[model samples]
Target chain A: MDLTVTGLSVRLGKRAVLHDISATLRPGRVTAILGANGSGKTTLVRALAGLAPGEVRLGSARVDTLDPRERARTIGYLPQDGAVHWDVTVESLVELGRMPHRAPFAGLSAEDHIAISHALAATDTEELAGRLVAELSGGERARVLLARVLAGRPAWLLADEPLASLDPAHQLGLLDRLRALAGEGMGVVIVLHDLIQAARAADDVLLLREGRVVAFAPVAEALSPDNLRAAFGVEVMQVRDEAGRILPVPIGTNR
Target chain B: MKRSTLILGLTALVALLFLGSLMAGKAWVPPSAWFTADPRWWIVAELRLPRAILGLGVGAALGLTGAVLQGFLRNPLADPSVVGVSSCAALGAVGAIVLLSASTPLIIFGSAMLAAAGGMALLAGLAWRSRSAVAFILAGTVLASLAGALTAFVISIAPNPYATAEIIDWIMGSLTDRSFSEVQFAMPFIAMGCVALLFTGRALDALTLGEDAARSLGIRLRRTQMLIVVGAGLAVGASVAVTGVVGFVGLIVPHLLRPLTGARPSALLLPSALGGAALVLAADSLVRLGPGATEIRLGVAMALIGTPFFFALLLRMRRSAWI
Candidate 1:
């Protein structure tokens, strides 16, 4: 099912962060919301995930109107900070994703176990399952946090800046994982600051400027020099890599 | 250790300590006296049995609330006593004793519970705007000090010296000479509070990922907050009304058991409850066997034990730079 947002506006303490935003996010595709700071990328994604107040629909049903558990079952969201208060083990942390599916007082079922194993395997975190999250490195923690979201098996996964603080290799690995998830018929939406990474990994790009959409199109068209300049006020030099993929590298401010 | 083994061990420990509490008073009641009609049986049936039962219920209530509050607030220092709920309940109990001349247990129990609920309400209201841990702790400290001052004021203006003495002794907290009536009065509230707290384990588990992610996982924040407030209020209120303020069981038990439970807030709940029961029973029994001319009050004994542990915890936290 496609996730749709229409006429969505969000105000955080009298300051409007997302204004009249509308987009249709499809299943089995990765949509990267790209913008500079304060462009409302997080707010837009939060609204789509039903964490913020807005009109969002999954297929035809209003997402905000759906039961919280049902909404949770369909949409998995990861915040930017990804705060873990307790020093629980990685396996236990991943098991938390199964909360929306399990009945109260019921132990993990066969389905939950399978999902957890799949998430661990997909994220290459099977060996780290027994280790405490507090002891994990930044890159490992990012993967484990993503695995937690994946364990829920939600149709749509919304992650805000999941690549922040990750090394280059880990960033590429995460993008590959997200692409693989999309290939397996899961809708993946992520907020990204790296234009090259977004262009390489995302099927489509939604560029925003000052809480308004500058362009929502396929990566090639959406990340054009004009759009990049308009959205981020940056002059980007598009360079083709060995795989013949266009990579936009920001050169300087668009003077 | 395995979760099952830990739970079983804690349960066994609680059972052993419970039996020990009944047997190891100032006058020892041998196991043979339990079956045969020995005059010492009265000590077991009438006096020690009720004390032991109250110890179990009150201990479990405090421990479970401590774990729940710690999880809910995402603060390790959070407990009924630390967050001023116990002090507010104590204030209410003191008011009832002063105003009603300690006429009825029901009046005192109800007043304490109501005051605890009010304290929780005020705490929530004060800290609602800020999600920061410091704000929550500051609000709790202010409420606790306010309640403490009111309680002292109530004591100062007591109608007579006898009432003042009784108030002071009760405030020291003891399980001595308690009968089945006190158990009947407090047990139901404790049980209800425990049941409510147990239901929050899954939510607390979800909350380990923080508020936004927990909400995305379908944990109802408001409902969980309500359960914590009501649960702590009733549990701590009834405990104070019956045995006065039994300090530190809530704070100490959870911290001691967290390592064994792998620091998962949800996993720590039951073990903390059992550990709390064992700790209180052991402490109460130790006081009974003390060399003092009179038995040390349970609250005073717990403070004596807990203060050093708390200091060590703070020092460790400081060394680790957690603060």
Candidate 2:
């Protein structure tokens, strides 16, 4: 089922953050939301996840009208700052994702155990499963947080700046995991600051400028020189790598 | 230690302390007194039993509230008193004594409960819109200060010296001379409050990931906040209304049991409740067994113990860079 947004507007306090945004995000595809700072990337993603006020529909059902538990089971969202307050173990942390699936007083079912193990393996956090989250390094913590989201096995995954603290290898590893999830008919949306990673990993790209969509298209068109210059005010020198993939490296500011 | 084992140990300790509390008064009534029809059975039944029950209920309420508040605010220093409900209830009880000149338990209990409900309502009104833990804490601090100042104002203008002494003695807090009526009056509120707090464990566990993630995980922020406020208000209000203001059981028990429970808020709830009961029962029993002619106030004893523990905690937290 496709996630659709129409005439969506958001205001944080008195300032308008997102204005009349409309988009259709399909299942089994990775959509990379690329934008400069303060371009409403987080806001847009949060709105889509029903964390912010917006008119959103999942297939034929209004996403806002869905039960909170059902919405949580369908849409898994990871915020920009992945702050874990307690010093709980990695496995315990991941088990928190299954909260929406389990009853309040009931213990974990066998299905929950399977999903937890799968998430741990996928994020390569199996080794850190027994370790406390407070003791993990920055990159390790980021992976564990991502694993927590994956444990829920939501139909749609929305992550904001998930790659911020990750190393290059882990970033690629995460992109691969996201692709694998998309292959399994799950809709994956990520907010990214790295244009090259977005272009390389994303099936569709949504570019934003000052809370407005500059372009929403396939990678080739969305990251085109003109659109990149318009959205980010940066002129990129397109270089093709050994695999013949276009990598856009910003040369100078268009401003 | 395993969570189950720790809980079992704490529960056993609470049971033991309860038995000890019944026997540790000025007149030591042996366990044989119950079966042998000793004349001192009235002391066991009429005097000590009610006090022990209150100690257990009050301690459990404080401990449970402390764990819930700390988890909800994500601040380890949060306790039943931090939210201002206890102080507001104290003010209500003091007002009943000074203004109405009523020393009756029913009037005092009703006034304190009403004030605590008001405090909870005011807290909700002030912090509801921000929906931030920091905002809630700030609002609580403000209300606490306001209630404290008002309580002082009421005391300064007391109608007589006897009333002032009575007010001072009551504020010192004790479980002494408490009858079964006080126990019956407080148990229902304490039990209800605990039930409400127990339901908050899952939501509190979700909150370990912070507000946005907690909400995304299907935890309703408003509902969780309401539970914490109302639960703590009812429990702490009734406790203060009955026994004046017993301090530190809520704060100390949760902090002590957090490591044993593996630091999960949900896992800490029951252990904290049990631990709190044990700590309070032991303290209450010790105060009764003290050498002084006048027994040490339960509140005073807790402060005497809690201040040093609190200092040690702060020093340790500083060394660990946890502050």
Candidate 3:
């Protein structure tokens, strides 16, 4: 599935947060949205996920026009923090992902169980299934929440700053899992602050300045120094590693 | 405890307490009297039965509403009484008693309902303005205090001494001498409220992930809020209309049941309802057993029993950040 956004705008009270943002997010790829603070990256993702009032298109369907259940069926969204309030078991928390699919009064079906197990296995959280979510480390809890969204088996996953709090190793692991999801033809869109990680992991990149899209292209083409400097008001330079691959580095912002 | 065991145990406890409540009074009525055409049986059938049934309904309503409010507001301390709905309803009832000479039950019921709805509307408005749980708790405390003061003010300026005495008893919360008419009036609203609340179980569970995630998962925040607020208002309003301001049952029941139900807000509802019923029945029985000419108020008994538990829960929440 391909997720598309056109003329998406958001206003919180009187202040405009996101304006006329448009992009194409293809399946079987990881797209990272890079922006500075208050750059409306979160707003754009929220609008795409149908959480905010905005016009978004997913394939031929209008995202905002779809019912909430249909929207949930098509897209799984992970907000930042992803706090689980209760001490529920990991399996039970994951089972909640099937809510959009199941009837309100019905018990979980065989298909639901299969999806739950696949989600657990996919996120490598099966070992922690019986344990309380509150007992897990921060990275582990993030993975469990990832499993929860995965259990819904949506065509696209939209995550806001999902990698913000993770250490380097855990970030790499989660990025790998996300990459695996993309390899399975699920579209993954992530909001990120780290330019290095974006250069490393993103197949495509969308750079935002203020509320508008500045660059939307393949990672290699879009992460140019000029685009980086414009989007973040920072001096970015490209350096070659021992592997002879170019990497983008942010040294400092001109005050 | 396992979910099934917890549920079953609560149900059994409610039943046992209910029977004990029917048998308990100023004087012991034998079980044999229940089978025969004795005056004691008349007392059981007419007096104790209605009061016991009211106790069950009132308790269930308060407990279920408490659980729903806690989830809706995302605050563990949220309850009908604490949030001012019960006291608002009490103010409505007392106001009616003071203003009207020989007010009918229907008028009192309507007044209470309106007051409950108004209180909920205010809470909803405050919640809309500020989504912070602490803000909501503070707002609720303010509203509760205001309603309590209004109730007292109305009582002091009551038109007659009889009206003042009636207001005092009602404010303290009592199921004494309540008839089947009160039960019939309250049951439908209570049942509707329970059904509405239980239907939001999945939505509330989704909310444990917070509002944005819940909305992304297709849970409509406005719809869920409407269900919770309206359902709780109806249940709590009708309950207070019959038995005034039954404090602490709502607060205590859900807290006690949370750990047993694995802290899942949805799973805590039924057990909390049953536990609330049992708690009220037990407390009412204690009121009857208290050695006094004038029966100790059921609400007073619940406060006496529940205040320590509330303190313990607050300490535990402080230790664990469970709130």
Candidate 4:
């Protein structure tokens, strides 16, 4: 199904974080929101999943018109900081992702159990199932949470800086995983601080500055030196001359 | 171990301890009496047996509800005492003791339930309407102190000979003279509360990542939290209504169960229930045998026991980099 956004606006604390932002994403594609810190990247993705206050009008029909309960079943979001305090087992933590699918009083059904197992396998956490979350490292926790998101089998996966805490290997590994999910016909939208990584992984990129889209197009035009300098006010160089320009680093700090 | 094995072990421990509580009271009875009726065994059964069982039920309810509240609020310090549900419950029991201490058993139990529920309603409003955990604790503290003062006011006006004495016991918390009927009355509310909390386990797990994160995942945050508050009130408030104010069972039991369940809120719920019941029952037995002819307030005993236990836990946690 086509996921379209039209005339979407959001306000946080009476300040308009995004004003009239609109875009469309296909089912089998990776879309990226590239921005510096505090540039409203987190808020935009959150608004799409109904985490932030915003109007999500899909064409003429309002996304807000859908029952929030119904809306939650179709979308899965992994936040910037995966806050955790309890020391629950990895299996239990992942199974919680199945909440929207169950009735209030009944415990996990057979279908729920299969989803939990599949999630553990997908995130490579089957061996860590019995271990307490407290005993695991940050990377392990992130993987478990990703497995949690995947358990829901939602149409769209929205993640905020899924690569931030991960090391380079895991970062690249996670990007490949997201790309694979998109190939499986799931819409994957990620808010990324790493422009080079975003360029490599995404089909379309939206560069945001001051809570508005500075550029929205195929990754090629969006990652050009002019766009990067305008959005971040930093000079950078690129390498790959493909559909997307890679910006791991620019030529020099000196203009 | 698997979830099934841990749950089984916890259940077995509760059963063995449940038996220990029955046999360990004053005026020890023959071991054979436990299996069948003896005329002499009737006295023990008639008096102390019900009190200890009631303690188990109340303790279990306290622990389970505590686990639920702490999970939902993401605060380890939450318990009925911290939230004023216990104090309000005490006030309810005190109202009966003050006006008609010798009233029919039914009236005393009924009044206790009503008072505790009233107190719970106030605390629930504070926690539900307000978003902050610190604010919830503050509101509970204020309500508890107000109830405490009101209880004192009622006592000051009383003309009975024991009013002054009973006031102290009521404020502190106790398990003395608890009858089978008290247990029977509280069992349903506590059971229902336990069911309510367990059912919300998935929602609680979603919450661990953050409220916003949970909401985006399609969990109805307000609805889930409201269920938790109501469940906490019934389970905790009814528990205190029966046994006065048994503290720490709630705070400590979850901590103990978390390791086995691996710290997920959903997995910890069942273990907390069983573990809490066993702990309170064991502590109740210990205090009964400890250096006291008069009954020990179970609440007082738990605090005395909980400190060293908690200290050990903290030390282990610190070493493990739990902060």
Candidate 5:
């Protein structure tokens, strides 16, 4: 499903946090919203997921006409620091993703159960599926979160830094799984800080600064040092081996 | 191993306790009166039976309301009384007696309902302003303290010092001297309150995951907040109206059962209610077993038992730290 945003603005009290921002979520690709802290990356992600209370203009297409629950059925959202009070098992937590798809006071159908099982398996968290969330390590928690987002079987999955706490192996594995989700025609949008990882994971990049879209295009063109410095005030020297790919090279001897 | 059997077992236990409460009262009725006694059978049917049910009813209300408040506010210390619902009920009951000069039961019941509503209104406002649990709870504490001091002040100026002593006991809470009239008067409100609170189960479960998470789940913040307010207020208001201001049942019931139920507000509600009933019934029995006609004030009776229970709960939590 195609999602569109037009002429969006965010004002927190008196300060204008996001300007007249606009973007389209292209299908079968990972779109990265990259920027420094407080650069409106999270806000833009939040807006797309319909969580933020700001002026939003969605298309008049069939998808846009769907009810909020119907929208939730297809649009998976993973908020930053999802709140949890008690220690529920991983399977039960993932099952909550199906709430929008089912009617109230009704148990999950067979298909819903299948989807939950599939999500747990895909995230490679089946081993820890019985564990309580509170008992899991930070990296384990992140994996469980990914499983939860995936369990909804959404057409579009929006995650706010899904890999913010991963070690190298799980990080690469999670990116591959997300790419695979997109390969199945699911649109994935992630808010990311590590530029290198964003370039490696996403098919396209959408850069933001002060809540305004700075770039929305292919990873190769948008990851340019010029745009990076313009948005983040950081200098970068591009590097590459024989593959003709750009590698992020940090400048200044801050190390 | 079987769920139905477990439910049946619990039901049986509650039934036995309920039966004991009816037959064990001061007035005795013969076994023949169990079926054939005329207006005199009212002792069991109208008086002790409803009182026992109220014990269970109020217990459940306090417990479930406590759980919802703590989950909604996300504060471990978020007891219902701390927010002035009970005190407000006391103020209303006091007003009904001293100012309105209403009937004995009406004065006891009406004022409690009014006071509980007042306390809840203030709490609802605080919650709306910040959606922060700790802030709302602290606000509740402030209001509760204010209500408590006001209760003391009102009693000090009471026209009859002898009546003041009785009023003090009522404020502290009691089922003493209660007849069928008190039981009949309180039944409907408590029943309505329990039903109202049950509606909050879904919202509370969603809320357990936190506000941002709940919002993303397509549950409106304002709507959920409203359900919580009305449900909690109704249940608490009805409970305090009938029983004066019993303390800590809400605080302790949910605290004990949270681990078993996995912190989902949906699952916690009924269990907390059941647990609360059991807790209060046990506490009431303890009071009954104690010496003298100056029956230990119900509120004080609960406090004496609840204080140690609260400490034990904390120590248990400390041992099982992660959850």
Candidate 6:
């Protein structure tokens, strides 16, 4: 089912963080929310995931109306920080993703094990299965954490700043995986800072500027030079190949 | 080793320490005496048996509380004693001893448990108000010191020197001269608290991903937090009411057993509880076997044992990204 956010506004201690943001994230499509720092990207994602109080609808059902467990099963959320406090193993950490699907007191079932293994293999974290999370590098940790969220197999996945800690190669690899996940009928919504990465991976785009959505459209339309300048205060020069596809890049900030 | 194997090993150790504690006192009771009309049988049944059982129960309680508190607060350094919950309970017990000496043990137990619940409520509130880990721990330290001062004030104002001494001895934490009544008083509360905490294993594991993720995982934040606070308060309060403020078993046992339990808070709970029971029993035995005619207090012995371990953990944690 497609995830939709409508008339969503969130106030953090009297200061508005997200203001009347609305977007329809289509299934089998990767949507990237692009915004300047403090422009409510994280708040918007949270509101969509029902982590923040707001109006979110999963197809026909209002998200907030659903019970938390039901909401959890529908939407897999990965927070900005991928830090796990304990020195837990990668396999154990990934297994926690099955929490919403399994009974609280019941042991993991055969299906749970299958999902966990699939997540491990999908994220290419099988080699790090027995290794402690504390011992892994930043990029490795991110993949393992993503695997943790993936093991739930939610219809919609919301990730906030997932690409922040990853290196260039890992970043491309994870983006490819997210795109592949979207192709498999899961709606993937990610908050990204890199315009180039977002332009390359996202099929749809939602641009926010100071808690307001400037545009929510196809990547080609939403990332127009005028919209980019308005949303990010930058004159971005787009480079296209002979086939007229945009090679996403920002030449400079307009100050 | 597998968590099951570790739990089994710890259980065996607890049994051994329980038996050893029964044998370690100023006088030893023979196995034959257990079934005979020997006066030593009374010692075995009445005195030594109660002490050993209380130590095991109280230790298990503290250890479980420590593990839960660490997970709930997301701070590895959190302990009932260090975070001031134990002192708050002690304050309640001390108040009862000073003013309500004529009152029943049940009333005192109630007061201690209530005060502990209040303290935990306040600490959890402080933690909620501020998301900073440093603020949470500092608030706990302040609360603990405040409770400590209040307990001292109550002791100072006792009606007689003997009463003051009695209060001091209790605060020092001894399994000495305890009867079956004290064990009877604490066991139910501890068990109730433990049952509450035991069910929280999955919630705690979900929490390792942090509050937002845990909430997104359908772990009820309010319910989980309530269970942890009330459960830890009940368990630690009951234990403190009987044994005074035994420090660090909660901190030490969980830290020691976390590796064996895969460092998963859920997996750590049972082993930590078993390890805690063993640690308490062994420490109680050491108190009995020590050189001094006046036995070393259980709380003091634990502090001495646990402080070094705490430093070692701190140093090791320092080398990594624990903070």
DockQ of each: 0.67, 0.75, 0.72, 0.55, 0.54, 0.82
Clashes of 6: 0
Best first by TM-score, ranked = 2, 1, 6, 3, 5, 4
How would you encode candidate 1's per-residue C-alpha lDDT over B1-323 as one tens digit per residue?
89999999999999999999999977999788995689999889999999999999989988888898888778777777767888998888888889888657678777787787789899888777664445666888899999999999999999999888888888899998788988998999888888888888988888888888988999777677667767777787788878898888888999999988887788999998898889889999999999866999999999999999989988887875234
Best by lDDT: 2
Error of 2 at A56 (Å): 1.7
State which candidate has the highest DockQ: 6
TM-scores of all predicted structures: 0.95, 0.98, 0.94, 0.86, 0.91, 0.95
Cα distance off (Å), candidate 6, residue A3: 2.0
Q: Listing candidates in order, what is each one's chain A TM-score?
A: 0.97, 0.98, 0.94, 0.91, 0.92, 0.96
- Tell me, by TM-score, which candidate is best: 2
Ranking by DockQ: 6, 2, 3, 1, 4, 5
State the C-alpha lDDT per candidate: 0.88, 0.91, 0.84, 0.77, 0.74, 0.86
Worst 10 residues of 3 chain B by lDDT: B127-136
Question: Per-candidate interface C-alpha RMSD?
Answer: 1.4, 1.1, 1.2, 2.0, 2.2, 0.9
Clashing pairs in 6: none
Q: Between the candidate structures 2 and 5, which one is better when assessed by TM-score?
A: 2
Which ranking of candidates, highest lDDT first? 2, 1, 6, 3, 4, 5
Candidate 3 per-residue lDDT, tens place, A1-255, comes to: 678887888898899988788888899999999998999998888888977767678888888678889889889999877878777899889988898998886889999999999999877789999998878887788888988999999999998887866778878888988998899999999999999888888899999988988899998888998889889988878987675656899888885
Clashing residue pairs in candidate 1 are none
Clashes in model 5: which pairs?
A83-B209, B88-B115, B89-B115, B89-B116, B92-B111, B93-B111
Worst 10 residues of 5 chain B by lDDT: B1-10
Tens-digit lDDT track of model 6 for B1-323: 88778878888889988988887777777676786898888888989999999999998998898888787667788787656778899888888878888346677777787778789888788766554445656767888898989888888789998888878887888788888888888999899999898988988898898878988898777777667767877788899988888989989988888767777888888888888899999999888887768899999999899889999999988987768
Expressed as tens digits, the lDDT of each residue in A1-255 for candidate 2 is 899989888899899988788889999999999999999999999888888878999988888678889999999999998988888999999999999999998999999999999999999999999999888999999999999999999999999999998999999999999999999999999999999999889989999988888999988789999999999999999999787878898999968
Residue B194 displacement (Å), model 5: 1.9
